[model samples]
Target: MKRRFLVAFLLLFFSYSLNIYAVEEEPSPPPNIGFSLNLLGPIFGIYSLGVSSFLTSRVQLGLNGTYFDTRSVDPKVTGWQTQVRMNYFFSPLYKSGFYIGIFGGFESVQIKNNSGRSDNYTDPIGGIIPGYRWSMTKKLDMLLGVMIGYMYGDIQISPELSFVYLL
Candidate 1:
């Protein structure tokens, strides 16, 4: 009798479990593009702007331009750079999370010596960047990272901070 009761209870439990239902949620669409401005650059006499687009849900393509000048210091330096970068995000969404990227670009710099003579040079630059991005609001976000790269035949590490406005 106990064996018969156990089999009946098991069958009833399986039938009830199979009738249970679950609801699935739909995901929001990924962001298409974003524009970025470097806030820290202005504090150090550099101005920069960038635009980025989503190539897929987890990949992005970006272009940036930057300019800087130091007129008050001896051996004053002035320069500009244009870069192209591709980022692969770790999270499912491309707009926010941790990402690793590679960037390559061309840069030009002019140095003015104490003798008031200016010399200009240009070079190709490339780097690897790893960063974290967080959303501030529905349409605003911030990125913080470091770029380690070769520029002007020297290995340089630069801090990266920017605000992105999504559209």
Candidate 2:
């Protein structure tokens, strides 16, 4: 009986030691930086530039800027916007593909009337924007999204699309 107990204790101790010494997997490295730019139309032109850094293989943090110009009417309207995003890649790293994310940012709008009309109002605007991104390559990408919030006392909704290139 004593021999059996001694053998059992030795077995249990060996198993416990093995469990403690088992190898663990290392964490994945972060994502590299990326950028994109976009043209809406002849009346509307937009530029978006950003950087994406991987927090993990699947997740990333991004900072971006958007510049918009509209020239449909006699007056030309322009806006400057900025955003920060968190992204998730659908596929593994080193694969050619795309990524999606949620973003929020600040925007400012200004309108100028080339006609020198009395109806023109020079004002500075502010708002919030949300959007998503798709990567065509490691250095180039496209994004589509919207902005809905308050600019001055008015509620505005602006939809935007852009392409970006990493440097």
Candidate 3:
């Protein structure tokens, strides 16, 4: 009777311990997607937002839309532009989060005079936007960068500062 009681107690204890271990397993978190709002200075200003997802470990593809406004010292030389861009980022497989990439896309610009006269133009613009992004937490980041390129029959170089929130 003593031997049978001991075996039964041991089995119950082991089963209880296994159950507790199973219940303590943690669930994995969802993958992170990034978004940003950029301010590109006085002569020209742009606001852009995008989402990126990794296809491979080091390679990501993203789509971005930008609303751009530009004005010369003369109000008669004001223009509005819009663009859709596709981007690719290359870094080490494990270090994909910190790196730079080249972006290219289509842009349309409309320039108007306060006199109510308007001119419209469309073109392909490509440039390098070099910047560093640091993850503040799982859902917030700080982005600082600059973009230099050509558009609308002139060369463009703009400095940008932005705060990004990931959802």
Using lDDT as the measure, the top candidate is 1
- Give me the runs in candidate 1 sitting further than 4 Å from their true place: 1-29, 72-76, 94-96, 111-119
Per-residue lDDT tens digits for candidate 3, residues 1-167, read 46744663465456445544442422134235656666444335444666665554434456666665655533333334443433332222222133344567776767676787777668777676555555566566565555657765466766556555645
Clashing pairs in 2: 31-54, 35-164, 35-165, 36-163, 36-164, 36-165, 37-163, 37-164, 38-163
lDDT of 1: 0.75
lDDT of each: 0.75, 0.55, 0.52
How close to the true structure is residue 86 of candidate 3, measured as C-alpha lDDT? Answer: 35
- Top TM-score: which candidate number? 1
Local accuracy of candidate 2 as per-residue lDDT tens digits, 1-167: 46744663465455445534645343355336655445644435555666667777657677777665766654565777677767554444443333445556666766667865423223434444334456567566565655555542356665767665644
Q: Could you tell which candidate, 1 or 3, scores higher by TM-score?
A: 1
Q: Which regions of candidate 3 deviate over 4 angstroms?
A: 1-32, 39-45, 69-98, 112-119
lDDT of 1 by residue, 41-152 (tens): 7766778999998787667799999997867666676899899989766544523456667899998988788998887769999998767777677678787776879864
Ranking by TM-score: 1, 3, 2
Candidates in order, TM-scores: namely: 0.73, 0.49, 0.55
Better of 2 and 3 by TM-score: 3
